[model samples]
Target: WRRGTNSIAVLGAPQVILYKFGHPSDAWWGVLPYWAGLLILSAPVGLTVYYFLNDHTPPKSTPLAAFLLSLAFISSCVWTDLIASELVSGLEFLGVSLGVSRSIIGLTILAWGNSIGDFVADTALARAGNPRMGAAGGFGGPLF
Candidate 1:
């Protein structure tokens, strides 16, 4: 059970690079997750970020900082995928236990997850004889 939980925690199999940023002078650690692995992983990162943001304040923006920030932003996308996969897995298990059809469960979950507004708008547009526009709108609606 512990092994399974640990395996699932690293769902995306992210690369394990050991980045050792020097510690901050002042002692201030933010709220931490209730997991030893996370504590080990995030302590250095949180300290590094604190060191950069508070202590070594940048007067002018550097390209390296921009690139690092972009990578951090991109990590959110990975987190989203991880969270969504867990949600879907839980929903699937519930459906199976409840003796419900997986297809029906999928349809219900997907419709709500993707938003019924997208379905209605896309359908209306496609029915009104513009499928390309409908398809484009369907894909683009979530961006806004």
Candidate 2:
């Protein structure tokens, strides 16, 4: 693997370093493609202009509605975190029982387990004729 001056060693595996293109001294926009940087910077500006020109009104939502939605979101986040921890623990136990290496277990089982939902959602979107969005999620989900 090619290592760059900007790369940092991966946790638990000191030999592995992830690299990003461009030097650390390079401007933030310099790291991205010219068109990508332009688009990223311009999108919000364009949207704001469009909304202002169109005189679009924001949706009216009650405090109760907002509170309930926030509560639900927080609850789901906690629930998922718990589920993921349990899953990791279970996978570790199974890997030990099967005499599998930690690296193999992490790379295969943990990776797939975490990403299965993204895979399914992307697959569904692709099947529904929104392949571009599906492709985006497929490629982008793991990065986040």
**Error at 108, model 1, angstroms:** 2.1
Residue 70 C-alpha lDDT in model 1: 56
- Winner by TM-score: 2
lDDT of 2 by residue, 6-105 (tens): 1111111111101122232334545764434444654554444344332333224755335334534654565576677788889999999999988999
The parts of candidate 1 lying over 4 Å away from their true place are 1-49, 52-60, 116-144
**Tens-digit lDDT string for candidate 1 (20-64):** 222322233544322444446555544454444433343147663
Whole-model Cα lDDT per candidate?
A: 0.59, 0.57
> What are the per-model C-alpha RMSD values against the true structure?
12.4, 18.4
Top lDDT: which candidate number? 1
What TM-scores do the predictions have? 0.44, 0.45
The global Cα lDDT (0 to 1) of model 1 is 0.59
